[model samples]
Target: MAAPNTSTSDLYRQWAATYDTDGNILQAVDDLQLANLLPSFVQNLRSSRPDGRLRVLDLGCGTGRNTKRLLLAPSSMPLEVTGIDTSEAMLAVALEKFPEATYHCLDPFSRSSPLPNDLRDSFDGLISTLVLEHLPSDVYFSTLVSLLVPGGRALVTNMHPDMGSRTGAGFKLGGDGVRVRGVSFAHGVQETIKAAQNAGLEILEAAREVEVDEEMIQRWKGKGLERTAQRAQKWIGVKVWYGVTVRKIGDRED
Candidate 1:
């Protein structure tokens, strides 16, 4: 089989229109997990910084789904969210949905300085869902560490490394029936942990989940995607996603 075209920005631009409605099971799982996990982090930040607004960076915030989630979450402190993505098309949809949040168009991999200097070590928390696989290891850890203040927390999620070989860690026809694929790189669990430690982040928690369940299988069957349902069934108990929470323990060198 030929490799799926992995042009990151172009592919997302083509897929942006249908991304939200794509009935993506993985995305659904991510949403649920993030919803459950984010509240505690936000609450902690709020308690620590009672006098000011909490700043958050949503890296690779495609269509702003996770960004909106963070904004909607009930918090004691106000949230100032800034979302960044390489594809203008993706950012356009996100901006439309949440005009209140700041959106930036930037190529994380190609840019020498992906974020503004003024924002360095300013964020109270950072969240990147299903985005890390697309970033180089050095860039991944360095950018994450740079954006967070010491003692700030971060949540990073990606397709499980074990499933990357099977699924290429790349995009396919999302639930919306768009035939688009973006480039992705595979990094193992140990590699991710090591990167965080090397960047002076203290790992708080790590989890892996098998997103496919009977409910998801039935939903696929209802949509008349029998093959997809079968594929989902085959992996019912197999882990397909990984999430990690780490805290910045030291100040950025720069």
Candidate 2:
């Protein structure tokens, strides 16, 4: 599949209209995994600051899918969320869906781009789903550290580099019927871990998921794309996406 050579922001702007309805199985899997892991991380944050509300930043919060999930998730303490994305079209849709949450339109990966002063080192937890692949490894790790308070936790999910190499570093129809493709970078698992360590983050958990089960196979089958479903079945045990949970341990150098 030929991927788009456009900038990430332009790609998402074009994709914004159909993103939510795109039936992306990788996104579906990531959401399920993150949902399972977030409560424990949230509980940890609440335990540390019993009197204060937990504040979260949703990086690359396209259409606020993960942002809404974080906001609606059941938690012991009060929660406030802020979302940031580079595409105005994407943010427009997100703002409409989540009017209460703060939204910013900025490129987090830009070296000159700085987060609002009030938000620096202020978040209790941060969640980024299916977004890191578009960012440089160094920028991704450094930005993650800068956005969190000391010992603040972050949950990040991305396409596994191994899988991305096989599938290429961009989007495809995948039986989802969406034609949009974005530019992406493939950062290996060790490369990400080393970047986080260099940024003074302690890795707490790392996991990879591969799904080619009957239900998943059936879903692809339903899309009427026999070739896509066959490919999925062929890569049954191969890692699809990877998730990591890390905590900031010291000051950010960048």
Off by over 4 Å in 1: 1-3, 111-114, 169-179, 215-231, 251-254
Q: 74-178, model 1: which lDDT tens digit per residue?
A: 886669999989889999999989888998898655565556776778888899998887777767888888878887889898877666656643344544343
CA-only RMSD, every prediction: 3.6, 3.9
The 0-to-1 C-alpha lDDT of every candidate, in the order given, reads 0.76, 0.77
On lDDT, the leading prediction is: 2
Off by over 4 Å in 2: 1-4, 168-180, 218-235, 251-254
| TM-score of model 2 vs. true structure | 0.85
List model 2 lDDT by residue over 218-238, tens digit each: 766786745556656765766
Angstrom error at residue 76, model 2? 2.6
RMSD of 1: 3.6
